[model samples]
Target: MPRAAIDVISVYVRKAQKQRSRLPSFRSLAALEAVVRHGNIVWAADELGVTPGAVSKQLGSLEEELEAPLFHDGHRLRPTPVAIELAQTLGVALHLLREGWDKATHGLDTGVVTITGNASLCMHWLVPRVLAMQAAAGGRAIRVTSLHTSDTWWQSTVDIAILRHRRVPVGWESQTIGTERLTLLGSPERARRAAERGIAALGGETFLAAETRHGDLDRWLAAAGVGADTERRDSVHFYVAIEAALEDMGMVVAPIALCHDLIAQKRLAAPFPACTIRGAGLAGAYNRAICSPRTAESLFRWMKREMRRCSILPAV
Candidate 1:
């Protein structure tokens, strides 16, 4: 063959090869989201009870399908911009679809929907409205799990997750309950006495922090510019710590929303002024992106409305 003709043939073959290569299947997208949320393929695999290699292959498939890498962060399993964008866009509808399909084809039940959240908050702020949601959603059961800061629901079968967050995530839609400020909560007498001298005078006060809290200390510090140092302390679970502090025993820094009723009732008091915490409060977000059941979607919407009607998102 002539040299030029041979070169043209090679170029055509390469172009053909590129088009023939493909990416992953629809199932792999689920794996990609699982890996991003959980923080590693191994953890994702463990959560899914599948092999790491299988997770990896699914991830590879997703990347191929997208024609770009989904994740490229250092946290081993965190999402890249592409992944975050994709998750934000695709998470809700997909999960809802899956759930709907499962119920339609696989004898799934729409009878009960279990939700998990911080225990006390759920009991006090969220539980009262369960019946209203059930009524609105065709008598569906809404079970509340309180005191949950992590994904304890991973071990159990759950329909939805509801909790507090500083911001509604980009991928998920949320309904605002109400807003509250953060206060350096303590025994009112102690805080008043501490205030008399100076703000930092309570530096040696006992402190309590949540296990996997979001912006607990930062919001507290930013609110009052907290520089006080505590002399003695214990690292109890967040709920326990808050409960103890509310009893007027010690000091805790928490969002006022979590302690609002008690504070108004004089059970707890603000160590600093109310305006300090900026007060842009939390709302309830349904991770519709991650769930795909029509019944669950029905339940999620019903719950959000019930929350609004019952004022569960914000205490009022």
Candidate 2:
């Protein structure tokens, strides 16, 4: 358990005792926490192994005891400020208690550290270096989960997240992992033609675009000072776009981090290296309330080292 969590719990207990007010039952508090965390009574009830009615009753009991409403009545429950704060504290405390119980029953070092990130990044970057990451973790088991680009950090059950945001979100600790440098990539033969004839050589070729990166092609084109009109094909993901590019379908603008290995293997080529556009800054995020800072830092450092190894240009 973190000392901060212990202190917060102790303070809560002391305040309840001083006021001579009974602390809410553990079940009621758990219900409140789950409901607020999930933002859906049915989901919370499912998590707690109870019916929605039961969860509602628990929430009512808690509200009655405290003489205050915790959630707004709407299609979706919106937690009040107090509810959010209490739920956050309870979340940390409960997670620590669960960890303590797990350690006592299963023994220490039994936990698997889960790292989640963009699916393309996991496939092209992290998956290849997972063994090195594990070794850097001092032999601790590591699990990597790929998340869709639209998935939020709160929706994941990961120990660490490779987030696109440079700023740390509230309630989480984070470190800058890398900057994404979007580069124009294509098949070797197409790249050779472009290198010899400049950007005009690919004017007739299709532009493979990823739906997730809607404006990246235009951005890269503007950065590269190219004004030629070209046909385009859109894919749902960067990986698909890259695959299309590899098959000589079209040129795709992608993060170098995702295509660096292919480039190194001579499977793909960057025709205009100087035209790389700076993209989102990546961060490694973790809940300090539950994750050990030292462990998170170690993993973050390894991630940084690996990214640096694959990067073809300096982050600007």
Candidate 3:
């Protein structure tokens, strides 16, 4: 072989190796990001469109490259401090990447704000009144997706979220839509029965509950000065619980705003008038974005108005 040919091949190989060494594999980085974001291997696998084993392998490769442990091995998986920090930075970077992609695909402005939240809120509150979103957007469109509050993976999909909690997420802008006022709602007949038999009698009546809002009934009963029996009850979704109440299955502690339409239609009645649950409420939140401030602000305003109109709001 010619010495000049050998030299050329050697230079090309060196250049390629250097380029590869400078850049971390996106696959490994993505796996690590997903694991950190979700705080687990199974969920990270779901997010990355792969198996848990695949995610574990990627994490192992990443750890070997970085020479650090990212997660603690135990009964419950938890991210290491370094992993948490990396995840936070990655989330911001992903948001920026999304912004760039948005600009490329939809141009500088599209006026679309995607929202996600509890399914009950979506069905009972937003879905019925989505025209309000259209009106608020002027000519722009509002997209909504419903998910269980337990599912935090929606972060990647939604521009804003209407969480059933008051905690303002870190690194995000939040508007308190309002504190949800509690009310003991029931069928009109049941309300009449409670009114006639006296409100205290409801303490012994069958009640519907939700797994998530486990102690709400107890809290409301305590406030009402009644000792709840807590027997002869069934658990279901907030929407389903309301449906059962409408069917005269039992009484339920529901948000007044969510029950407004039913109350207006006379299908459901609040035996106990609306009352506030201290330190509890829903919030609308979005990532900080410079280009769509007006759009996000407009939606936030609309959310506040809706909450107020339905009496879900408490003094902020």
Give me the candidate number with maximum TM-score: 2
> lDDT per residue, candidate 1, 152-179, as tens digits?
4435554455556634344545555555
If candidate 3 were superposed on the true structure by all CA atoms, what would the RMSD be? 18.9
Give the clash total for candidate 2.
Answer: 0
Q: Choose 2 or 3, whichever is better by TM-score.
A: 2
Clashing pairs in 3: none
Least lDDT summed over 10 consecutive residues: which range in candidate 1? Answer: 307-316
lDDT of 2 by residue, 1-316 (tens): 5555466457666767876988889999999889988989999999999999999999998777656688877766898766777788889779999999887654523467788887788888878878888888777788888887666655455678887775455778887989888888889898888888887555666789988778889888877777647789988977788888989988999888778888887878888888888888899998665556667888888889878777773332
Task: Sort the candidates on lDDT, descending order.
Answer: 2, 3, 1
Candidate of highest lDDT: 2
RMSD of each: 20.7, 18.0, 18.9
Q: Report the Cα lDDT for candidate 2.
A: 0.80
Question: Which residue window of length 10 is worst by lDDT in model 2?
Answer: 103-112
> Which portions of model 2 miss their true places by more than 4 Å?
1-110, 166-170, 313-316
CA lDDT of 271 in candidate 1?
A: 52
> Candidates' lDDT values, in order?
0.60, 0.80, 0.72
